[model samples]
Target: MKKNNINDNDIILEDLQPSHAIHLYEMMQDDRIYTYIPENAPAAVETLKEKYKMFSKGSLRKEEVWLNYAIYLSSEKLYIGTLQATVQLDKRIISIAYILDPKKWGAGYAKKALSIMLQNSKEQFGHFDYYAYIDTRNERSINLVKSLGFKCVEYIENADYFKGSSSNEFVYAKISNK
Candidate 1:
């Protein structure tokens, strides 16, 4: 965890501390959660450590591929999961990705947290569109995004980079600023 200058009350989106790494590592223990993720199973502690190090090093700098945030419940101050956005500055668009603890699934935490992130990004980046790339098989996530106003733009075949030879991808978008 790099030295984070995030204010005590500014939602503390990124630059997570080492103390929070264990909780995040534990959250990755579920195999079902990694079904659509671009990584393999057995998400061990070392994997979490590597991810944290990569985040600390700010390695996703090519075109601002993505900025990851550790989602926390504001009232409980408990770490829920993560949200990320990949900004296409040329297009003035942002695509989002998120995951929550399995225990927290179906509780609307992902929706609420993602909504906050969308609003924050809109404020910071001015008028922009938001998009989501969801695994077609993940009906729950697809439905959740639809509920948030993202319309299905297209169904992509063999679109995922790390799919287990079984899943398809769908691109969805919500044009708020356009």
Candidate 2:
């Protein structure tokens, strides 16, 4: 595995580190990106940095492993987003999560980053089910997962409530063969 970063298609999927918190936290401040996300949870840069430190170290539980990567645009020389994978070791499942700066939306950054992470995930954790839990109102994310060949396996009504929306979620999953 590449310890420094994984490069491809003009983007770099840098292994998540505490140092990335500053830019990421700044980027995430865009209100457009929080439509389906909890607005209150993003405490502060320091808090984010501390959380990232632990994520970089990995999950505290034995049954789960965490993998996070910061999406960097080589040409733009910026950190645009992040991808997170929570691997449930016992269940052989990888619960995927991701977020990109609203300004970078539809620029293909999320797709590329996710693809790279999925590939690297197989290398590090072996074949496992990759699952993305997306809010029903998030059509862009839902479409993105579908384009990546993730089938909607379940519809969870009231999975969460955030941003004045009673959230219904779609559990999307795709199995890894490699």
Instruction: Give me the candidate number with maximum lDDT.
Output: 2
- For residues 22-134, what per-residue lDDT tens digits would candidate 2 score against the true structure? 97898877878778876554678998899789879877798988778899998988999888888899999999999898898998889888888888878888899999988
Candidate 2, superposed: residue stretches over 4 Å from native? 1-4, 41-43
lDDT of each: 0.72, 0.86
Worst lDDT 10-window in candidate 1: 1-10
TM-scores, all candidates, are 0.82, 0.91
Q: For candidate 2, what is the TM-score? A: 0.91
lDDT of 1 by residue, 1-178 (tens): 1222222352446544445567677776777788876775435767676776675555455555455678776667677787777777678889888878898899887877777777767766778888898888888899889988999988889775665475578999998745
Candidate 1 local distance difference test against the native = 0.72
TM-score of 1: 0.82
Worst 10 residues of 2 by lDDT: 1-10
